[model samples]
Target: MTVLRGRGVSLSAATEGGERAVSIDVEAYYRRYGPQVLRRCRFLLRDEEKAVDAMHDVFVQLLRYQGALKDAAPSSLLHRIATTVCLNRLRGAKRRPEDREDELVLQIASADDTESRTAARGLLDRLFGRVPASSQDIAVLHLVDGMTLEETAREVGLSVSGVRKRLRALTAVLQELELEAA
Candidate 1:
């Protein structure tokens, strides 16, 4: 008999010679990767509590897919999973009441005039709209999250040189937008 266990589910199957137990210890995996996963979620979500929740959600997903992902790279796989989970959350999200107040306060404090802030925001929106989602994700991981190029590349499944090239292209787009505005 072969006994398999994962995520509180267990099964026993017939084997030719002897009994074997294959168990996936999800707690161990969570302990190993929880912090890293949380960081990835925070980078994507920009909220600490939401990041923690997303990290837990990623672990739950790992439980569901652990069998198939046995041979996968843990960090990259978890990062990708966290990214997908965060993106999904963002997709159907509505602005929270407290967040609106916080945004208003931040905008008032940071901007000398409302017009420039609005212009800058519009420019940023246009720039982001022009970029591919993957490149945006890479930029956020490296730039916003302060991840190293190689680390971002690993998480994004890209070569370091490819990430660098995309960053350069992003910079060019910014420059073009600035010149057009001027």
Candidate 2:
């Protein structure tokens, strides 16, 4: 979404001669792009409270880096921020799963699936070990989160073909690993 031009608070910048003002239309940006950012948070978080919190966190990051972030692609920037915020929350949850593990266990635990779990763990290590985490993020955005290749490229700051090549290489690795497993 485009950051609409309008009245906003100005920040002081230290220049060669003196301090100057850098004005950012933050309200206009929030008005135009808040819904998209909130939707992305909700999709990734699946919790109303956390999603709202994450949305606010994304905007806070925007405000924090207002001077550096350009207006060329605000939508993609917000989307990327939302994804990162939610992903960080998810990782944090892993650090302390006991708070919610009671119900989660009932839903996802399988007593007889040790072999499957081991196999899946091996597959994950092999797939993720050789690649950068950005590649894994791309895979999640495109394959898990259902983002388009163009969207994924924008979020990851890569070309569409670069994202595709990463995915292709990942797929090839998976295929080879599958054959080895077989």
Candidate 3:
């Protein structure tokens, strides 16, 4: 919710992990990003308490991955992480076998535009059905959250070309699905 407001300059420490694990100023980051992350959670989980919990969980994940963290785009990275955390929670809530045909991926909550949100809500399941699950993540980040290709690549830990290929594959599958739908 909060972190992806824009590109963030890196603020890390060179000290080894201890009581201070991440180099970044943690309190400042929470103050800067916590609102947006909470906003994101509320939008997705549709529960105030759950949203708060998930937002905190996002920061915890950031702490967990601080060692390998390279990109300065904390907002984008945190947004992706927040989405992932909430989706996992949603998925876990319904622990039955994945009813892929009927289940909507809750990450599409980022499709904030009214028309696009409605449009995306229905197509997303079909889109995921026809392509790799990772592509589904790419589509949500790029197409739904409106992150640029490079930003999406960094967030998803893929090369831009690799992201492009998966997106292209998604387009092909979408075309086939559209033709079938028609």
Q: Tell me the whole-model lDDT of each prediction, alpha carbons only.
A: 0.72, 0.73, 0.73
Per TM-score, the best of the predicted structures is 2
Clashing pairs in 1: none
TM-score, one value per model: 0.41, 0.45, 0.42
Quote the lDDT for 90 in model 2.
96
lDDT of 2 by residue, 63-177 (tens): 8988776665667878988899999999977753322423322332343588866756666788778788898898778766668778999999999889878877776666677
Per-residue error (Å), model 3, residue 40: 0.5
lDDT of 3: 0.73
| Cand. 1 Cα-lDDT | 0.72
Per-residue alpha-carbon lDDT of model 3 for 72-95, expressed as tens digits?
677887788889999998997575
Ranking by TM-score: 2, 3, 1
